[model samples]
Target: MNRSENTATSAAPAKITDSGQFKRSLGTWSTLALGVGAMVGFGWVTLVGGWINDAGTLGAASAMLAGGVMMAVVAFVYSEMVAAMPKAGGEHNYILRAMGPRWSFIGSWGITGGYATVVAFEAVALPTALEYVIPLDHLHLWTVSDSDVFLSWALVGAVTAVIITIINIVGVKIAGSFQMFVVLFLFLIGFLQIFGSLNAGEVSMMEPLFSNGWAGFFTVLVVVPFMFVGFDVIPQTAEEVNLPPKKTGRIAFISVIIAAAWYIMIILTVSSALTPEQQANSSLPAADAMATLFSSEFFGNLMVAAGVAGIVTSWNSLQMGASRLMYSLAQGGMLPAWLGKLHPKFGTPVNALLVLGAVATIAPFFGHKALGWIVDAGSPMIVIAYFLVSISFVILRIREPKMNRPLRVGGRGNFGVIVGATAVAITAFLITLYVPGMPAGLSIEPWIIFGVWWLVGAVFFVGIPGGVKPGPNAEEELMEKVYARYPHRRP
Candidate 1:
């Protein structure tokens, strides 16, 4: 295992240097809201429609459940780690402390790569959503090509990225508030659909529920993990929290439960409402499915609003998460020194946000389908990072037995932690491998894209001049900090 980079020693933590006026006072609810904001939008709303279209309704639902189970296990593993570590850079920080700096560099890239692909997914979908709600015929003057829709989508993506970058740079409080409102609204709308559909709508029995073969269910399972990845953002903001451990554990677990229940209701209602032909045919199947229960225009407008809001929140939350990881890396001497500088006025990581936004904004020109391909290809790396974190949990338990854990995983000694972590790690990897090759319509080859992304990060992390030099007593320093704050309790 390679050593971790933790050498950059400032006089004190950077938070002490800033005025701290713009520092966020977010708690469990806000963190949960951000997680829901990141994950709930397109994946649950529009993308579920797409998945169902490709695989039958039953196939997609089965896949969703399989993915959810894997996600639940991984979430438990991560919860244990976050409860112990409770800092920025998330898996980057965990992997380094356990495996070494070299692997940490790869972990950092894995996280950033995931965020960039998510941005691409949101950017591409935002415009397609707009066209569904409002026709762009009058604005044909701005159209550049035979495919006016494609041009419109690209512009929309770029514009959305700019807006989200500004929100992220402003700091977490504003961003958290925005996400809270959007996610709350999303939940309300979902609940409304459940109740409303039950009252007036004739729920047709989806006979032969397990319509998709075992292969199709497994295929959908691979793709479904991407939906859960966005929730990792909650724990990444641990440093910014007023109470890190309490807030992280409470928010993360609760948010997962809420999201799961909401998703179940949505799949049941939408699937039951629409016929197989209707589900397969429409691009915006959710809107069409709901239209049978409600008026067409009303359903379409509601979904468009939800989709737009979801993308904005997802983009903003991801921008914040990715930028913080950069700050953590730079402060550790893994990257350029300038990136460690927080914005003077806002106390936010402005430089990192700008860089992340630039990469994300450029991805949409390839079109919506291509953006989906990018997200799919990037998905494997994130699962790998989670698997590493799960492994790290057990290694850290044995290596740093005396290190104070503010929030400890309960059981006889470290046995439970090891078992939970190993289970989560193996399950995530297995699911990632289980999903078959990408469907025909998607652009990038899944294996090839995943390979290139990993290769590029490996070279940059190891080859570059400031290639993550490991610090002496890195683990000791972290242990001291942990113990000072959280003295071990005797049973």
Candidate 2:
């Protein structure tokens, strides 16, 4: 296979940043673990099952397949961008290079909100899941009553936030290793579920093809994007990868392939094991499906334990990745400078972690029902971000025709990858609006909160200094500053 000149050199030890705080310690498998850990939490357990129940097995599966395909196209485009720039800021860096500093700043605002919101969502999900396994009616800690479910959720979120912060501070090596373990266990549990259900053969996978029609199909389409969000996160770690662009792109492709197949198995297993009525009404569909297949008390409990563990692990990784991205953006002057400070000894952006924790901790009290709203608001934000990123890819290809692409998606002359990705972006945006106010039977007033948040983000992008449009002279000055700090990284 052909390789870029930097390919061989990339394997050499990565030079540490001047602050001596950031370094690239991740390998291919470690990168894959990061992607898996970010995407496979509560969504895999409750979200996917709930989705299947809403649209029926056929509609859910097809939408997931479609979403996965769309994400794959995006992965290809994103991989190409990261391979070229390999910066820690991920989408922020990509947008700046392709669109301009101003638009990139706008992109950073949305990306920051997405990461923070999702992390908070994950933190709250853990305690909510615990209510299923534990009977804590009268427990009290530090004069606080756990009786108020929201209080318990806040406490859990706080504790998990601390754990994630500590892990990130200790360094990427430790954090990445923990993520690897989480992914391994999650994969084992998922596979066990798929095989155990497949063995029963009590239900047919193809019994109903598309029972929900376009309405059902669109509902699933909107939710499936949440499940496949981790692939894009791979680019966020570009600067920390041993082979910045090439290795990052290759590992991302592997991650998408692995995650897609795993998610499909989950859909199939759940579909085969649950009846229509059981699926629709069941609170925890995957766990219920496993129980039906096994008819064993031990396995039933195992499903709950595995599901909770998955949520916790996913919560941890998402927070870590998101905070790091925010920290990177802040250092570039796209955000408040205070957000960029690293703990003197711990080597972490502890303040940023605290900020993210604050957002997530308070979110649950806003009402778990409101999470749907946050998600709805976040959905359009991501779609808009994706649209820009994809457009950036095509523009960059034209602007930098001589630029090296360590991994290109289509043939020499074919723009199918670009065209297809753009089409998916449009489709995803259209489908997303259908579930804007929440589907029937669900109250999603919290989306208003996100709507307000988006407006605030817009203001930040336009109001802050060096926040946007660094100007032509400023770009060169900024490059000289960045290079002076990291002399080892100069081309």
Q: Which digits, one per residue and each the tens of the lDDT, describe model 2 over residues 418-467?
A: 66357446645644454537442223444566678767767656643442
Clashes of 1: 3
lDDT of 1 by residue, 1-491 (tens): 22222222311233212223236567666788887777776766665555555455666766676667667666766676666566666776777767766677677777777777787778777777788777534434233233343555577778878878888787777778888888877766676677657865554544346554775565566565567667788767777766657458666656566666666666667776776677667777666666766766687578667767777777777778888777766654456645656788777778888888887688666655556667877776676667777777777666665544545565438665766666556656654472565332223376567778877776656643322333324534543433343343100
Candidate 2 error regions (>4 Å)? 1-18, 139-153, 343-347, 361-367, 411-447, 464-491
Structure candidate 1, residue pairs in collision: 2-100, 3-101, 4-101
lDDT (Cα atoms) of all candidates against the true structure: 0.65, 0.65
After the best TM-score superposition of candidate 2, give how far the Cα of residue 190 lies from its true spot, in angstroms. Answer: 1.0
